[model samples]
Target: MDVLGQLVAVPTVNPPGESYGEMVEVLHSIMEDAGYEVSAVEVPRDYLERYIPQHADHPRYVVIARVGSGRPVIHFNSHYDVVPPGEGWSRDPFRLSVEGDLVYGRGVVDMKGGMAAAILAAQAAAMAGAGDFGTVELSFTPDEETGGETGVKYMVEAGLVSPDYVVVPEASGSGNVWIGNKGNLWAEVEVRGRQAHGSTPWLGLNAFDGMARLAVALSEELNSMLSSRRSSYPFADPREAAPTVTLGGAVSGGAKVNVVPGRYSFTVDRRLIPEEGLEEAERELREALERASAPLRSAGYSVELRVTSRSPPSVIDPRGRLASALSDAVREVTGSPPRLTVCPGGLDTRYFQLAGVEALTYGPGDDSYAHAADERNSVSEMMTVARVYALLISSLLSCPGGPPRSTSS
Candidate 1:
């Protein structure tokens, strides 16, 4: 609780990446005091300029701590960055408030609480002489809330740490283990037309009308295409196992009611199942848009499509050693077999999964409160996660005559 309080008080919010250095320093101290070799890996300014230019001045850092050495390495990761506390809080979001077992703060539920648990788990395992069997690594990273381009992605690409198995404490919630996460392809469609008086509707090509036609065509075509496509993976919600599209998350159009809309654009939030690939999803979307806008093009309206961002879906074998070990630990600590599932949204696990290293997510707190106002987590839940982590580490490192550690890359 003390460690969690200290972490929560730092307020490592990410857009402008405030207090990242302070957060890294606190983590360095905690890891060092727990008797681990610690290092702070800063994101290079030039790299940031190429990837994320707006926040280049703020800087980014990932704190890595290691104990023991050699094969069967187990890596634990969690991000310190929290989303901006948007609205409605009973007290200060930066101050940790403990009332009985529930602790309240901004990052407590979303992730810092889980990071604290991971720290304690690693510390307890090391103190119990559990490091004799293998190596354990812990990393506290930045930029998860805004995508981990400079965090886990950078770590993996820079060869800062590599492990046979990875645990990202992302709070699958209610004692469930997340084996994967959905990917996304964000896009924007713009329909351009000439403006004229609303009274003479025939004189101008109405962008709104063209946009409406394209949106409806897209919904129909995409829905039909995705209808037969469902993920083979298990999700806590059955609907999440299938691909989905949310249209018009943001929309913009005309200035005056009397003017025919000259321009219109809407954002597309297309979610992919683990079975779907980014390239195929994008191609299908573009083809559909082109087919739908053919008539609009002939009618003097111009259509444009922009792919804002895209990420690949990630999954791990549920029956693999990493999943079995985590499931065993959950059952041993909580007396319930965790439901192996995939998250509805993306996570840093994708980075490791993309790197061909096995990774999974399990931690404390209900995921619903991740970005909610008065976000909080139960102390008992955090401790439970810590116990599970400790047991998992012990099992992976010290289990005798278990699965042989793989020597291949």
Candidate 2:
């Protein structure tokens, strides 16, 4: 609880990421005090300048802690960054509030609680002399709330970690384990027209009208296309099994109520299922935009589209040795087997999986409350997840085990 309090107090929000140095220091101190060798690896300024130039002044860091040595290393990872706290909070978002078993704060459920749990679990396993069999590694990374360009992805690309198995303690539900997550494709579209007085609207073109047309076209074409395709992977909701598109997440247009807007722009969020291929998805979106814009162009409006980011879907066999070991630990600690499912959201596990390392996610808290106004986590659930992690570390690293077979979707 004390550890969780310290973590929650530092609001490491990730758009232009705040207090990253302080957060890394806190994690480093915790891991160092736990009798593990720790390293605070900072992302290079050049990389930052090239990729995220707006955040060049804000440094990024990943705290890595390692105990013991040898083959079949088990790595536990959690991102320390949290989303910005929006409106409607009853209490201070940065202050940790405890009521009975509930712990409330901005990042409590979205995953600083999971970070604390992983730390405690690693400490407990180390104290039990579980290091005799193999190595246990813990990484507290940054930029997951955005993309992990400088966090897990950077580490994997720079050869900072080479683990046989990885466990990402994301905010999966108490009785659930996430073996995979959906991919994301973010894009922005812009339209240009002439500005003129609203009283004589025919004197100038309306950019907003073009934007509306494109939105309608997307709703008619993209939505219908997505409806016909569904994933074979199991999800609690059938709707989650299909790809989804959300438009106008951020939109702006018009100079004033009395003026015709000269320019308009909006964002797009497309989530791809595990079975979907990235190239095909991109091609479909591009084709849709091209078809929709032809009419707008003929009507004297200029349209432009930009794909800001792309993350391909990643998955692993749910019945593999890593999943079995973690599930056994969950059952041992919670007295019931956890259901293995594909997360409908994006996760950092994709980075590890892309590196050819088997990975899965299991932790406390309901993911539905992740970015909610009153995000909270259960104290008892946190402890239960900690015990589960410690037991899994002991199970896999306390004895010799062969390398698990590689499997992917």
Candidate 3:
């Protein structure tokens, strides 16, 4: 509780990306005492300038610590960064409030709480002793709220830390272990038209009107395809059984109300299940854009397509040894096997999975409160997660001889 309180008190907000050094220092001191080698993987400022301009110059850090060495290495990845507290908060977003079994704060539920739990688990394991052949590592990132481009992405690409198995513990689902996450493709399309005075609208072609037509046609085509296709994966809720398409996060066009716009554009967010191919889906979207804008193309205007970012969907087989160990730990301590499910939205686990490092997402708290005000987590659940982590690490790291002794809390 004291460790969690200290973490919650620090306002490590991401948009502006500040105050990471303070938190890293605190983590190093505690981790070193637990008999782990602690270090920081700094994201170069120049790299951030070209990749994530929003975070340019702001120091980005990935805090890493490990105990033991070699063979079956188990890594725990979590982000300490929290989204900006929007509104309607009952109290200060940085202040850690403990009421009975709950701990309230902004990042507590989103991720910092998970980080604290991993630390507790690693500390316990060290005190108990981890034999040769098993190594435990904890990696805390600084930019999960911003898509982890400069945090986890940078760490993995920079060859900072690579383990045989990874557990994100990203506040996935309350009692379920998340083995997969939905994939996404973000893009923008621009339509060009001649600008002219509103009084003589006939003199100029209206780009906004042309773009609206394309949007309608594309929406119809995407929706029609989505209806016929459903994911093979099982979801607890049957309602969300198909892919999704969302257009015009914010449509911008036209100069003034009186002026006929010369150019119009809109952003699109398309999500695909693990069964779909990312490249194929993107090609379909692009081809559809071209086909729908054909009528406007003949009128002497043009259409431009730019892909913002895209990531393939990630999934893990529950039959794998890593998952089986985690499941066994859950059953040993909690007396019930944890369900394996897929996350409805994207998270950082995709980075590790993409790197070919086996990864799973499991953590405490209701995921619904992630970006919401008055976000909190149950202290009991956090401790439970810690126990599971310790047990899993011990079980996976113990010699290949006899079954390891129980580390159940």
Candidate 4:
């Protein structure tokens, strides 16, 4: 709880990804005190983007704590960045506001609390000589809320961590381990038109209108497939829960009401189920977009698409060693086995999976409260996860440098 409070106090909002350096130090110092050799790596230059203006000046730091050099290195990762604390709030978004058992604050449920739990748990495991049992790597990353190209993605691509197993303390319900997540394709599409006085309507093309046509046409063509592609993952909105596309995250173009829009741009959030092939899905979308934009092209306009990010759907083998160890640890700590879940959204676990390393997420936060106004986490839940993490670490760090025994000591 103490660690969680300190974490929530730092406002690491992701829109522009600010104050990452501060967050990195807090996590670094705490783990260093617990006997881990920590490293702070700046977010790579190539990863920075002008779209996130803050990065042009504000530095992003990925803090990594290495406790041992043993084999079967197990990684516990969590992003420190939180979404904006929108709208009404009873207390300061950066400070922890408590009631009964709930700890209210921005980033509490979505993940900072989870990050704290991992840190404390790692501290306990280190005290138990768990590091020598096997390697334990705890990474605190930023830029997750905004696609992690500059955070986890950077670390993974740079060979910062090559763990045999990874446990990301993302918001995965009470203590359920998230074995996989539906993939995502985050893209921005633009429609171009010639600017002219709005009074002379026929003199110029309206990019906004052209974009509207494209959206409608794509929807008409893809909505059916989205609805019919039955997903194996369990979601509350099953009827409409298949692979899907959400268009127009935000729209921009016209500068004046009297001027024809010269250009229009919008974002797309496309979710992919495990069964859906990413290439096939992207190809289909491109085909649909090309077909829809044909009319606009003939009319002397243009369409351009920028794929900001793409993550393939992750479906880990649930019976793997890491999953088994976590399950055992959770059962020991909570008196029942934890359930395996498939998330509807993306997570840093996807990057580890991309490298063929088995990874899962099980943490303290309540998913329902994530990114919502007055986001909060239960102190009791955080404590429970900390205990479970300690147990899992000790078990996985057992005898062999590579695999745990049939049961932990």
Query: What is the per-residue lDDT of model 1 for residues 1-409, given as tens digits with 9 covering 90 to 100?
Result: 8899899999888798999999988998999999899999889998788768999999899889988877688999999999999899998999999999899999998898899899999999889876667788999889998889989999999999978889998878747999988999999999999999999988998999999998998888889888888888898988888899988999999979999999999999999998889999999999988888898999899999999889988898998989998999999999999999989898999999999988999989998998999998999999999999999999889766444555431
How would you encode candidate 3's per-residue C-alpha lDDT over 35-127 as one tens digit per residue? 999998788988889778876878888899988766577899988888998999998889898899988898888988888898899898888
lDDT of each: 0.89, 0.88, 0.84, 0.83
* Candidate whose TM-score is highest: 2
The reply for model 1, stretches above 4 Å from the true place, is: 196-203, 253-260, 401-409
Clashing pairs in 3: none
- Mark the 10 consecutive residues where model 1 has the least summed lDDT: 400-409
| Best-first order by lDDT | 1, 2, 3, 4
RMSD for all candidates, in order, please.
2.4, 3.1, 3.5, 3.3
lDDT of 2 by residue, 231-339 (tens): 9987767778999999999998889999999899999899999989888988998888888788988988998888989999888998888989999999999899998
Screening candidate 1 with a backbone cut-off below 3 angstroms (N, C-alpha, C), the clashing residue pairs are none
User: lDDT for model 1, on a 0 to 1 scale?
Assistant: 0.89
Deviation in angstroms for 308 in model 4?
Answer: 3.0
Q: After superposition, how far is residue 181 of candidate 2 from its true place, in Å?
A: 0.9
Q: List pairs with backbone clashes in candidate 2.
A: none
Q: Measure candidate 4: CA RMSD.
A: 3.3
Q: Return the TM-score for each candidate structure.
A: 0.94, 0.95, 0.93, 0.90
Error of 1 at 52 (Å): 1.4
